[model samples]
Target chain A: MKVSDGGTVLAADVFSSRCPSRSVLDHVTSKWAVLVLAALAVEPLRFSALRRRIDGVSEKMLAQTLRTLEADGFVDRVVTPTTPPQVTYSLTDLGRGLTGHLTGLLGFIQTRLPEIEAARST
Target chain B: MKVSDGGTVLAADVFSSRCPSRSVLDHVTSKWAVLVLAALAVEPLRFSALRRRIDGVSEKMLAQTLRTLEADGFVDRVVTPTTPPQVTYSLTDLGRGLTGHLTGLLGFIQTRLPEIEAARST
Candidate 1:
């Protein structure tokens, strides 16, 4: 329908091909995006720490995912003016809200693995 | 850590590269998978109806997504012994559980579109 932001109203429809929400949804649910959100859910982490926490994620993918999340207002990127220029990433309020749902999905999949595997075999 | 199915215990870890849950998670969260699940959440539909409901999904991608969801025990495929053989796809009990979380995520994204767009413009 219509989403009102201050005085500016926007049409919202994920089912539409031209809706921006489609892209936003894709970014938030991307493989690396889910893992990054999961890792950050534990604690805010620097770039290097984030890379280590998620298995099988390349440097480029991680960077791209973070940028997409940041642009969507789900991630906060802070730069420390240190000798080495440290940057840490954490979930914003919006990001945390989204992460709660993602965490639930992840937990469901993890706990029900046996049932899922059995389903596959049968 | 451990998930027990009857007497057989399974280790559950999505963070590990070798974990089967990783693949399951991928299937559930895949672009087409999410849309297909969402579409089926309404009611059981045949292959053609499902393809029409989701925008921008190709014939090949729709078939592949349905097969993946079925193999994961999230979808049930029923075929009728008619002249042309009618096939219908619907969510299993397990699929319903996961669909709840996915519907929540999709709703959140749809409702927060304005905020996400504002974040991008800033």
Candidate 2:
């Protein structure tokens, strides 16, 4: 994609358009992403704590989601220099802002669960 | 999955747990789902109108999203029986509610676009 302004030509950067932004979208809205955001919204938690908090999530998936979120700067992963190198995860400022949005989305889903279930029955 | 409620043994329905609700989640937070809900929030639009309003979406994907939203009762699809069938799509009360959620999510994404972009560039 290219945009021309006056006499100067500006390349919109197709790599930027189709690569990072799209990838970020996919990560933020992934299945685990929603739940993880919600989980971290309340407070930072340890790896195992997060794994247990979210019901029915596999450890592998959780780790993967956390890594992606970390890469995207939505999650802050801290490693404590402990006996076993205890790692904790928390939301960054931006991540917390994103969590507010996640809360709204999840709240809607939880509140409307009954109605949605009813609709599906028919 | 099995649950015990006092003296009553409840045989938890696995199919129900894994099917409709999950299916609904897949549709509601789907890439197009958020946008479709947001689009309908403004006003009812015809099929082609919606197709055009959303950028970079394929016809097949739009049609699929509309059908899923319709089936889930978030969207009301009206077909006028004329020489040429005129189909319009609008949000149901439930859909509007869902849109409120989507708005928050998308609003966050849009507002954080700059920060997110910067993060990805690194």
Candidate 3:
């Protein structure tokens, strides 16, 4: 348990089912969410560009993930009124804060892939 | 793409469906896996103690999560031939390395819960 600067009593025990942090954790660490965050860390990208960069994500899943991240204050969604209505997504300051942590985790796994694969074989 | 000291070529792009690192990332970040790793960070824990610490985890899920972590070389399971077959779970060196990154992420979420909640309401 921790007391926020705002004096709100905060309990972030992910072990506890009642913790609100668990939902945010789930959303941020979801399969597509991680990939999306990693992709956007480089720069803001349009919906089509994001979809292309993230390999196999379906449009529906990508849209949902962006919405979820946006709601969590980790992503910014900008809509422009063009002939086709351009939608671009980028990391919010909060989202940028999380990118390094996630990318570090992802990079570790990538670098250790050989070791992990060897373990899997045996 | 990066190459290990052992001269093994590594491709850890999680965006690619065929990447082995993707599976490792998924297992390590699974809901129970994160909580289990966080719990084990402080000290080794018996099966029952771990179950109790992680509030709502089912016996089956806990067992499965442990096995997955062990297979990934991130967790060590020690079994003792006791009256009830005492088993303790702890982080391996690899697991310990990841603990800081994960706990940092979790701690951030917990501390920022107030802000996240406010964002949700608006």
Where does candidate 2 chain B have its weakest 10-residue lDDT segment?
A: B11-20
Q: State in Å the error of residue A16, model 3.
A: 1.5
- In order of appearance, the predictions have TM-scores of 0.92, 0.80, 0.90
Candidate achieving the largest lDDT: 1
RMSD of each: 3.5, 5.1, 3.5
> What local lDDT does model 1 show for residue B108?
91
> Native contact fraction of candidate 3?
0.63
Better of 1 and 2 by lDDT: 1
Point out the higher-scoring one by TM-score: 1 or 3.
1
lDDT of 3 at B7: 83
Clashing pairs in 1: none
Order candidates by DockQ, high to low: 1, 3, 2
Docking class of 2: acceptable
- Listed in order, the DockQ scores are 0.67, 0.30, 0.60
Model 3 chain A weakest lDDT span, ten residues long: A1-10
lDDT (Cα) of model 1? 0.89
lDDT of 2 by residue, A1-122 (tens): 23456887554321133433445666887877877888899889998998877766789999999988987789999999989898999999999988887777666665566687677668
Taking the tens digit of each residue's C-alpha lDDT, what string does model 3 give over A1-122? 35343677666677677788888888888878988999999999999999998878899999999999989999988889999899899998888887788888888888777767776777
